[model samples]
Target: MQGILTQITALLGVTVGAALIAKFLRQPIIVAYIFAGIVAGPLFLNLVHGEREIFHIFSQLGVILLLFMIGLSLNFNYLRRIGKVAVAGGLAQVIFTGVIGMGILRAMGFAFMPALYLAVAITFSSTIIITKLLSDKKDTDSLYGRHTVGLMLVQDLVAVLLMVFLTAQGGSMTISSSLIRLALGGLVFIVGVTLLARYILPPILRRIADSKEFLFLFAIAWCFALAYAASRFGFSIEIGAVAAGLALGSSTYQPEISARITPLRDFFLIIFFVILGAEMSLAAASTVFLPSVILSLFILIGNPLILYVVYRLMKFSRRNSLMIGLTAAQVSEFGFVLLFIGRELGYVGESEIASFTMVALATIFVSSYLITHNGKIAGAVQNFLAKFSEENHPQREEKPPVYDAWVIGYHRIGWNIVQVLKEKKRSFAVIDFDPTVIEHLTKEGVPAYFLDVSDVGLLSELPLDRARLVISTIPDIQDQVTLLKHVRLHSAHTVIVANAPEAKFMRTLYEAGADYVMTPHLLGGKWIGHMISDGKASRAAFRKLKKEQQEEIRSGMPVQEL
Candidate 1:
């Protein structure tokens, strides 16, 4: 105990120093910890030496806590909202990338199993990194951000199933029987957790709610207890942790539990990253180094392009689709976990695992900057796309001399703005990328064009600068930034109302010369607060609101069939 504690103390000092340097350099804190581990590792200063087992356990705890938090945050309604896009678009991305990645690995002299495992593993982007970056940017509610989150949820489910298969792999029973036993065990465990959470747990929770200390202890105990139970039933401890959190999700105490657990989770997570960094020592081998670089390049570049094509086929605009794609340009924590499991199962080696570690490190570092500067990156890409559109895209010979008002990316928030324009009997036109939206709007006698709003060359042909007003309901940062700049450049006096999904980018749009910037997430919350303050939270008010919102949902859809 004394020796391990001493090691931890040294590690703490080393980590703090690295974290400070990372902050000073404006780099990711995760990258810092990885480097800190390398510096302090037995391979270097040997600051941490005895019983690596303890650190390994702590790293697993970090993973469990992270997964549990994700389980707690799972929302069925959100999954339902973006279900098709998340499942279909996400699968398409994997299919394309998997095939390409498999070919790359196989050609690089990898065994079939290792190649397949690496291919599948690398297809999943890091939800942890993407979510944290998006949350920090206050963009978790943005259109592209929302799609990215939904896709992460889909990937999470797939990861869980993969873990299930891995868990069954080590059993004495045959694969089919092991799977059957595992499924039955899972079913029983879920039922028991459900019953307890619904009935027995709440009463226990109510008593603990008043004591912060007790609540925190209870949550940890409950989580570990579920984990132990799952392990006894031949399920992985990670799955149990996730199931426990999901069981508690309906409880009112979730917020308190999450708030209490987050700091602890983060601490353990640092240990996880440090251990991963120590493992990076293996990646320095000359044989693996070249292959790692090649795979990292594909993850950073090809992954986004593949996902962008998928989203484009799903009818998302170029700017929004590209923004979403950029969020997924790195390999996932699950990829690391899979490589670790494969090593344990003798399907892979330390060199293979190290190759993936290097890939994760490279892609995460590059993709962090990609996501951070998405607005500028997408803006630059849009410029190239615009030139291509001008050179090749078919254009209407005749164009309207002027539109009284123009609505860009007409859906969601645009629907309400369009309704108001119609009520005022103003001449307006809608621009959307979705052909069905254009068809529906045309059938309704609205002048809607199915075109990319970011196509500056195409937009130049349309007299958008002559419009009295321009409103963009596209809740994507890059889209709003590009549109705002283009409109301001052409006609400084136009009343350009743009949408931002968050306050930070709301300011960005305003600075880019938008006359008015709307952030629906912010505005909607403030509106609700005012309503509640004004005594509008009554049953009658809710009843009226329910009807109006239902009607709005029907009216706001891009197409009735969709």
Candidate 2:
């Protein structure tokens, strides 16, 4: 125990110093943790000692807490909204990556089972790392961020299912029986937890809500309890942690619980990264360096491309697709678990494990940098995409229609605006990437282009010179800025209205020459203030507001974070 304590102390000291340098150098803190591990592990100072198993147990806390917080962020409403997307995106991504990657590995001379296992492992991206980075940027509430989170959740679920089957193959259990048991156990587990979350915890939480200490303790206990309960049902503790958060996600105190637990998550996560780093040595890296580098390149580049294709097919904006896709460029913690399990089952050997370890370290390093600088990277790629698009598609020959007003996006607020425009009998057209919206509008004889806003050459063809007004409802600030500049440059008389998610961005829009900027929360607050201006809201007034909101909601797509 004393030796373990001393080892931990020394590791922490090295980690803190390395993390400070990483921060100072503007690198991701995760990178610093890995560097610290490499220095402290047997390859260097050899400060990582004591029970190795204990370190793994400790490192796993960071993974659990991160998942828990992600679950907390996924409020009930978002969960319902994301069900279809997550299922489709997650399954499609896995199948594509696994099959294609396995083929590539086979071509590279790996045996079938080893190739299949590695391919399976590569399909998972680190949910913990993604949530951490997104949280740091306060982008968890953004549309792409929401999509990425949903995708990661699907990946994690897939990983769990794969592990169960893989274990069954290695043990006495028949595959069919194992799957049957898993299905039943998982279903019961989910339903039971959902019931507890919906019915049991709310009242108890409400009662203890006032005491900060009590609430914090309850959150921790709830997280750990579910984590233990999850293992009994064949689910991973990470899943249980997420379930715990999902239960309380709808609570008013989610923000407080999340905030209080963040510091602990950070610390444990640092330890996790360091331990991952320490597992790699110069000898291990050198032995399988070529294959590791090849696989790492595939993960860093091909994973995002597959996801990019998925999002594009779903009619998301190219920029949005690329941004979210890049978040999947790293191998997940589950990938390591799968590889290690394969080693234990004798499906793989030390050489395979070492290669994958190098791949993990390499992919994590590059992908972290990619995620942190995704905006700039996506923008650069968007330009390349545009160049290819022009070479492939013919230039538009039809003269662009002239409209008095233009709606830049056709979802949520933009949908409402189109309704009002129709009521007023104003000549307006919608420009959006949503094929469904475009198809609907086209069927109604309203001009709507199924187009990406980032394609400048195409947008420039629009008759902005005759536009009386332009309203942009896209969520990306860069896209909004581009439209603002284009409209401002073309016609000074056009009154441009833009939407911002918050007040701070309103100023940026206004500075870019927006005549009126609508921020939903700000306007909602003002409307709310109007309601209570005469004192508490009357029952009649509340009912009227409710009806109006329902009617408004029915006018557009379902409510989403964007």
TM-score of each: 0.62, 0.69
Candidate 1 lDDT, tens digit per residue, 466-512? Answer: 88899998867787677778888889778999888778787788898
Query: In lDDT terms, which candidate is top?
Result: 2
Model 2 RMSD in angstroms? 13.2
Per-residue lDDT of candidate 2, residues 1-562 (tens digit): 8888988899999999998999899998888888999999998998877678889888988888888888887777878887898889999999998998898789889998888888898888888778888987767767778889999888878887888788898899988898898889899999999899988996787676656678779999999899988988888888899889899887656656776687888888888888988877456667777888888888888889999888777766777778888988988878778988898887777777778778878888888888888989988878777764332322222244689999988876887888889999999998875545655687777877654566554466468658999999888877888888888988899999998977789889998889999988888899889878967589988888789988876765447624
Runs in model 2 deviating more than 4 A are: 387-562
Model 1, residue 558: distance off in Å is 48
**Cα deviation of 154, candidate 1, in Å:** 3.6
C-alpha RMSD for every candidate: 14.9, 13.2
**Candidate 2: worst 10 consecutive residues by lDDT?**
389-398
Which candidate number maximizes TM-score? 2
Worst 10 residues of 1 by lDDT: 390-399
Instruction: Tell me the lDDT of model 2 at 490.
Output: 82
